[model samples]
Target: MKFTYKIDEKTELKMLDLQESEQLFYLTIGSKETLREWLPFIDFTQKVTDTQNFIQSTMKQYSENNGFQAGIWYEGKMAGVIGFHKIDWNNKSTSIGYWLSNDYVGLGLMTKSVKAFIDYAIKDINLNRVEIRAAIGNKKSRAIPERLGFTEEGCVREAEWLYDHYVDHVVYGMLAKDWLNKNKIKRV
Candidate 1:
């Protein structure tokens, strides 16, 4: 699958690679406390090598058509990462995951990037369903799905393991038919 997505003049999503692991590692380390609150894997990435291994694994997954992770770029800098956890080819569904740098919050960059990916998933990839799961109390993360018009399907109690404890996850879902209809009206 193609890896790069140009959302606009200032925003793009590019497939992450091993060479960029150091940069990604530093970003994660810098945002350790903030990111760790919601992401459990952050605790395992102790050094650059771990980041390299993670990126390498993701690259392999991309080749196998399982899933992918892309670095979100804003104004030519790595702002965050976003992508599908996996594509359920049988069910024509997928789940999205993402995180933004502390500095990039409130810029509407993530919302736009996510919207672009959802468009690609539904229109280009022909996916029937796309889902996002945000840890409970993560208003910032939850807002992306809400702003894009996904339905709040409910929550899974203690669904995600953060650093210290489990956190409930609010599930949001959107169907391609609904997204298509919405976009058609927008284009009219």
Candidate 2:
């Protein structure tokens, strides 16, 4: 949310290029063309306004709240969105959310992005816990956490209302210590 923590546009472009090899995608905060590509997804309909509103509001929230948000770039284009919500510096915790356009499905791009973001949050920001919650029945949504070594902490019944009626959510979490340990192995 600091607005100061920008991933360099050039680097972001390069990341998008690398992501293309893996079928990942991203969009800048206010890119109408990018958001347009994401609109067909059910998740975007819930909270996203138009390009102007989303960019203005999200930038404001990131500045005011000290949070992080980024576009998911895939195939050299913006294909999705991801961010850390409800960041608490005092508590050292935050919730993560993401959505991918259907065009980018069936690849492990989300998992790679999640791992990259988790590394940034824990190692760079010094956060303790990163949490992820997926709507019930969203197996693909939950798969990122499962692949990233997050614990399946259980479900919260009727926790979020999306698309229509209320829906249960499956929670997943990874602690800083666990991530550090995992890194040692990966480094080796």
Candidate number with greatest lDDT: 1
Tens digits of per-residue lDDT for model 2 on 1-188?
Answer: 13222333421212122223222312322333433332233335333244435555556656676665666655546656677776898999988877656566666667766776787788877889999998777777888999888999999998876545677889999999899898763321
lDDT of 1 by residue, 24-60 (tens): 9998888888888888898899999999999999998
TM-score, cand. 2: 0.73
TM-score of each: 0.95, 0.73
Model 1 segments more than 4 A misplaced: 185-188
**lDDT value, residue 180 of candidate 1:** 89
Q: What Cα-based lDDT does every candidate model obtain?
A: 0.90, 0.63
Error of 1 at 23 (Å): 1.0
Please give the clash total of every predicted structure, in order: 0, 12
User: How far off is residue 81 in model 2, in Å?
Assistant: 0.8
The positional error of residue 65 in candidate 2, measured at the CA in angstroms, is 4.2
